[model samples]
Target: MIIDYGATPPIEELSIGDGSHLANYRRVYASSEKAAARGEVDLDQWFRDCDAAGIGKTVIKARDVETTFGGRISNEEVAEVVARHPDRFIGFAGVDPNKGMTALRELEHAVTELGLKGLNVQCFENRLAPDDRRMYPLYAKCIELDIPVNIHVGINFSLKSSPEFGRPETLDRVLCDFPELRVCASPPGWPWVQELLAVAWRHPNLWIGLVAIRPRLMTVDHSGYGPLLQYGRTILKDRMIAGTAWPMQPMGRVIEEIRALPVDADIADLWLGGNAQRFLGM
Candidate 1:
């Protein structure tokens, strides 16, 4: 049972607008030929692809960057998808921290009323550091709701934002403040892979998501992802999560690469699905 922890499906509501900052980074992360196009995606084909890749569930996120970038994937839109295919999709709600109390209300609605299971925060895109005070309320809310948060913790390709906003060290403070908050810091925290690993080591509630990255690269020496493979099979075996960051890469290739990593069969299973099942309380 493979659960893709992070995915931006090709739905109309989740489509990237031309004026959005994500347009600038699309080419960098999006490998699919159709990814460059605007408008509704072939939803049927997307499900077919997931089936072929053996993806049992995919977590789709609604992103709200309205305060800074005028972008949003409304919770209603994400809920719609989950409503149609509850067995195949898990929805994560997005709230802009700059919205202050409004953001907290939105998150409560997303989880309780809309049935979204988690929160997705893109700090860089929102122009706030992970430990920024504005984000604390949402973290607290996640704990109150007993839902996990998936945070963007590594380099962001958007030219409009600095990668410093995503520095893994900032996460350490957030984790320290909310020790009970379940976090999935994603894209494997590259360029600071070791630092993120150290943070993950310190927090049992933290899990690293191998999203928007090439899994096979971790097996190569000097790839800077070596420690993840080394420690993931040992100390961090239960703390690793797998995600395709789909449309960034093909689902089959991502799953194949993860399965091909040089770890014991059981450890590989943890990275691919077991860990997420536990994290999502499945």
Candidate 2:
């Protein structure tokens, strides 16, 4: 039951642009002439690769940032893919908080009509902080729907927005306001790792996803993740889950790297998949 908590749905076409989130993936396909030539992902091949990596399931997420990012992928597109491979994939809905009530209705429609399991908020892409007032309605909707909220909770490299938008302290505000909101902070709130850990420790409903980060770095003394590694293997073992952020890091490599970290066997099991299973309600 190895579950990958962060991943984009397979795409047939992906064009590179300054605002495109997938632009970072260009480095990933640099070696594959076929991928570079077609500029598209081979859906079936990606599933085969996940199989080779021992990934039993992955959550498919979309990003809705048409204002800053130029375009948006619909929740319907993600839901359709999940429909085809329901056993292998779960879908998360992305709605632009800037749209206010329209966005709220979209989220309700996504979860109730489209069957998406969670909501995803890329605050940096939207140029909003985690505690931004615009995000509150969506958070409230998630609580009402009883679905989890997955947020980008770390420094984002894209110069298109301010890095401060991802500061982990903002999450504490959200948690305080919505005490019961099930939240998963992705990228493990890096650079602010300790802040995120403290928040998670205080909020039982919050989770951290190791997405787009090299797991092995956690054990490298000055990596700043040392305390996180230690705590994860001890008291916070159930609060962490693995997320490869596919195309940024290969699935097989991410799993193997986490396994090689100096953590106990039980902690490894939880981080690898068990925690995600519980978070995703599997």
Candidate 3:
């Protein structure tokens, strides 16, 4: 089965409240729309598009930034969709780290009560390093719940926070502390690709999701992603997961480009879907 590991469902509106955070997303949405208009995407349309692209299931993610820029897509919102289309969608919950124990309770409620599958941590949005102690509680909660975590682990372009916050090196400490935690470092940790590879090689539970990045660019000579592409097809074949980062790139186009990559059928299958299934324990 083809599973998309990370994707924002075609929600008519995302509540990214006012400020630089909201503005940054506005820019992201605007740039993304250049590839495919938002008017053409809706929940059911999203399912049809995924089907056309051979995507059997999609994990819908939501982000909460109440402590920072003031925005949220509550657990209830994501669970509603997954409840409506249980077969086609999986829900990942986002909790504001600043909420402390409250966030932990919410996460437990999300997985146990709401039936969410995993956790989504936008490290940069939280303005905390991936290894920040403030996030340790949440990590512990996820481990206790036996759900994987998808964390932003690369440079973030938003002006609201330092790009260093998303460094892949930070994850090393997190992995060291929580060796059994299933973590997917999103965006492939570009510019620090080798560092991430080493970390992933050291931690069997770590996975990489190619989100907000086109597979075609990974093969380009000077794209800075060439090494990642090489390792993904070879040594790290089972550690890679495909994600369209929809709106950033059209789902159909992303799938087509990935199919065109110079990799063996087995490697492609693992990268495209098998790895995600294994990571999520589906």
Candidate 4:
């Protein structure tokens, strides 16, 4: 019952479609996008990989690129897949909060009408700060639904240079202001992993993904997960989930990265998918 809170990009505008997707792995807009596409980890393939890896499920999110990713893959595309595999998938609606009320309405429709459970809000690009009270109504909606709102974290993403206004710290304001909100933090500028850890630790309901696999490809020691595991145990273990972050990076690579680590079997299992299962309440 593993649940990946982060996934998807709407395919629109660019010939490549999604804002991050690049042609021939040339320069997809975002690093995750490049990894997902060039790495060949779209929804279908990712599910297949996850199934093989014993990952029971992943919450899929679509693109609403008013500010960031220009919907590399449309919400309808994701909806169809989830509808097809009602048991294997959970869908998160994507929206540009920058659109204000319209964005809020779309999110409600995505959850209620589309049968989706969560939201992948690109608050960084919304041009509207996450702490701003404007998003309170939407936050309330999520709390009412009891679905986790996975926000971008630790990642310094520039959506076509569209003013990345989102940050992991901003979520602090949201959580402090609204105690009921449950959020899953996704990574990019993992440079801020410490900040994410601190916030999630302080707020039981605030969760962050321990982004695995490809990122390990960059670490010189291949033991980056070691510090992550130790840190998880120390502070945010209960608030952590293993997020393959598909459509941006291959799920298999993440597993491999974890495999290479010197973590004990029990702790390692959590990073693979166990933690996600708990957070998703599976």
CA-lDDT, candidates in order: 0.88, 0.82, 0.85, 0.62
Which prediction has more favorable lDDT, 1 or 2? 1
What's the CA error at residue 217 for candidate 4, in Å? 6.9
The full ranking of all candidates by lDDT, starting with the best, is 1, 3, 2, 4
Error of 4 at 224 (Å): 8.4
- Model 1 whole-model lDDT (C-alpha atoms): 0.88
Candidate with top TM-score is 1
Q: lDDT: which is higher, 1 or 3?
A: 1
Query: Global CA lDDT of candidate 4, please?
Result: 0.62
Give candidate 2 regions above 4 Å deviation: 13-41
| TM-score of each candidate structure, all chains considered together | 0.95, 0.91, 0.94, 0.78
Estimate the TM-score for candidate 4.
Answer: 0.78
Model 3, range 30-116, lDDT digits (tens) per residue?
755577656576677877888899998988887888888788888888898788789888899999898888998999999999999
Task: Write down the worst ten-residue block by lDDT for model 1.
Answer: 32-41
Candidate scoring better on TM-score of 2 and 3: 3
| Residue 38 CA displacement from its true place in model 4, Å | 2.9
- Any runs in candidate 4 off by more than 4 Å, and if so which? 8-48, 67-74, 162-164, 212-227
Give the deviation of candidate 4 from the true structure as CA RMSD.
Answer: 4.3
**How much is the lDDT of residue 27 in candidate 2?**
50
